[model samples]
Target: MSARGFAQAEYEARLTRAQALMSKAGLGGLLLTTEPEIRYFTGFLTRFWESPSRPWFLIVPAAGDPVAVIPSIGAALMGRTWITDIRTWPAPRPGDDGVSLLAATLDEVAEGPVGIPSGPETHLRMPQADFARLRAKTARFLRDDAGITARLRAVKSGAEIDRIAHACRIAARAFARVPEIAAPGMPLSQVFRRFQMLLLEEGADWVPYLAGGAGPLGYADVISPADDRPLARGDVLMLDTGALWDGYFCDYDRNFAMGTPDPRVLSAHDRLLGAAQAGLEAAQPGARACDVHAAMARICGADEGAGRLGHGLGMQLTEGLSLTAADRTVLEPGMVITLEPGVETGGGNILVHEENVVIRQGGAQILSPWADTLARLA
Candidate 1:
């Protein structure tokens, strides 16, 4: 058996917490197919999920431990987890592909309504046809448990917080080295590659996301992939990364001026920083997610065409509790979220600033160090 990342007691507490929620909601069991949900319960971590050929399932009964119904190939890894009731079937089997096994497992575990995540920010991780087949075979009514899972996962455990904080520190060290690795005239693609390497050297297990833009006054979009366009002396360059440590992620970004940025860009950067500060000040327990949004929106102004001021961060690059007017999730202690404020800087270009923090009773505790001022790279 392989070593487990989380202690057995941690897994038990998570299971107990989820089961309590399930019972309260009148759910007989929860069928989790997504990566985060499965690993959150079972401590079964692997990067083999890159292949879309197989489907894995975890059944958390309202009364007992979770059961793993997965591809036969993963049985050994599953064995290493705190979960003991492991069931496997040969996956990628043209038609069945563990659908029957999953259905049977669900039927055995649940007698009434079964809960699954089918709502916002969640995608059914199995093949569509297989899902239909499983539903038909099991004949169990499935309810949307996305909200229950979201509420449970939003609060970071002490260990989860430490992992995320470590990842933030690693990324901060890497960002500090960007001036030595990146230079004017270098293509944005090379900058991306070198920065990813730097992150690994700084102790990040993997760099899943690295996106940014470089232009005379900020970039057109924050999510655009790095292009071959060379960085110019007067350009404002931004690099946002989602680096992972122990399956937890730190989503944050940094901005740097190649030589001298436009004064408007500098002003926009300062405004964004102030907006983030406002958001942080409002991120105490009992505050709603939208309250944080309003605080930042007041500083940055409304409708700059940016989607959200910030969002909950953990398990994935983005998660539940969006920092927008529509999201009313209470900012409870232990929730880790990002404060991202974006400003449009004319000509379809925009400047974005981001920082990660853990919500505390007192206020927001910043995980990543703030970029005191816009970095100027020679």
Candidate 2:
């Protein structure tokens, strides 16, 4: 069994926090199934998340020790987590009575109104049978799936900020190393692969992964490299990479013009830099998150043809808080966000730049300290 990563006191504090949220929401207890939230509360990381045959459930009451219900085989791993008072069941085989075990566990702790994180965010995580069993037990059950969790996560703790900062540095350093591996006439995919390797060597847990190609215009989708197109003179190479450090991710992107730059590319690059700068400047205490987007949108214009500015970053590669005019979530201190400004023409000439920042009292503080200037690679 793995030793507990957090102290028992720390786990108690997390339970206190969860209970407080439940009280605020007028609920007796909460059932959380999200792995991130589970890991956050219990410091439990398991490879068994990949196995559907064995599932884990965390039942937290507003007034008692947290309960972890999982497979009998997984009960041993629960010792590594800070949480105690575990409930176990044998693996669900044909005609197995998993529901009896779940219902028994729930009945022991739940009273009054219980909260479950249902709907889109939670349906996939809970088994249909398990969900039905819980619903049948409590008539006062309400949908509170991830409601409190999102609010808690919005204001990151000091440890989380440190991890994000470390992740940001890894991404920035990886971007700085791009010039050495890129050259005109090399395939874009090759450059991407080399960049990924560099990130891995820098202690990043996974490839930051990059994309964009040579052309007169821009395209969508940065998840995969485009067709094996040979780099050409005056081609703008836009690279977007996300570094995963300590289970957190930092997304950073930059643009490099191969050979001599065209006037259009230079002008677009300037616009991107300006937009990114404006977005960063807009991040401050009490400012609505959408207000930052409105600032950047002003510079990028309402062109549906061009790429949108940047979004937020954290546990996932692309965080939902958009820096666009439509997003109105107020900005607050301790929030980390990404501001990426980009411009792409129909001809493949592209321009983009991104940076991660932590919102502070005065304004946003840049986490990744890389050059703001565009790179020209010949």
Candidate 3:
């Protein structure tokens, strides 16, 4: 499992790649506190971050291996990773929680400006007061290196792609059992619970996100939690999940009708599938992200007020690259992204179809089982 999750070489390669980017950006080192970024360099994987009571820190110098400065509870786990120099302190303390230690570590490792992710979709995972204190201590060496990290992580390795594909496969198997587990008159909340259990049984490490809606025309929103509304014949039901395998995530959704769907719903599903096809055809190694968006938008219509059609997926639920008209990030081989096309189906409702794929030299290789037709669950 350790080899499958990540070998020593994988971590070393990641660290080397990060150091090269830091060199190009003139950064002395990188200070990472986010869960994904920390795990990217070291093979430290744990669900302990859900508590958020203690902050963990990893410092990657421009030359050597990473150093982990974290709470005492995580020392054992961090010891198991490729990282050797581990620093720990009692966490959740009233005032001085690891700030001084982190400052000293940063000062020792980095001489010039140090990089931290401060751009889009990134968050500082520690207490604001602690951050303020750390900033005051190391004020002279701070810079935004979100782009440096983003560019390095956007393109995945073969192992990373396999992990993501395994996650996608787990979710797909769970989706296949929805027909067996769901029935008319069952509450949507119950469906969510049952489906999550199925995902776990089908080999998912966890189901971090599982949300969707059910309506006659479709659902008004896709991100809302499951409700007590009972399924009825002709209601279109959707379930979007972010399932994890090892530490990688698969972001995709599936749709089902209680009985026979409306002709229009079927037509909309067809259009969404066609849009995915167009997007897949355009997902070449050198194609811009906007090109993929435009190809899909041409089939799904440009009025999708659902923001970006899709986005990068791997370590987090959503990563750096976004498929939109404005984003110009070039697609590269080994980048795993979702092609999600949502269509407004009148009555203030919409239908969203999603599929995960890896950009290969040839084209987009589908990871999840293809939804050839809109499923009608009896």
Q: Give the TM-score of each candidate.
A: 0.97, 0.86, 0.97
In model 3, what lDDT does residue 187 have?
95
lDDT digits (tens) for residues 1-378 of candidate 1: 122277788889988998888878889899899899999998888999999888999999888889999999999999988889999988879778998888888889886799998778887898888788888999678888847787788898888888889889999999999998788999999999999999999988898999998998898888778889889999999999999988989999999999989998999999999999999899999999899999999988755566898898988999988899988989888999999999888888889999999998788999999877999998
Segments in model 2 whose C-alpha atoms lie over 4 Å from true places = 1-13, 46-54, 72-77, 90-99, 118-123, 137-142, 208-214, 302-308, 348-350
lDDT of 3: 0.89
Clashes of 3: 0
Candidate 2 residue lDDT tens string, 1-378: 122144566567667887888888887777767666677677676646766675567778778887887778877778766667877778764344455665666667866566776532334366677567657754546466446766566665556677778877876777778888888888887887888888888768775445565554434444456667777777778777777766677887777878777777777777777887888888887887678777776876534534346666666666546666666778778788888766665454345667888888888988888455768887
lDDT values, one for every candidate: 0.89, 0.69, 0.89
Task: Please count the clashing residue pairs in each candidate, in the order shown.
Answer: 0, 13, 0
Q: 235, model 3: CA deviation in Å? A: 0.8
Q: Is candidate 1 or candidate 2 better by lDDT?
A: 1
Name the lDDT value of residue 208 in candidate 2: 41
Candidate 2 deviation (Cα RMSD): 3.6
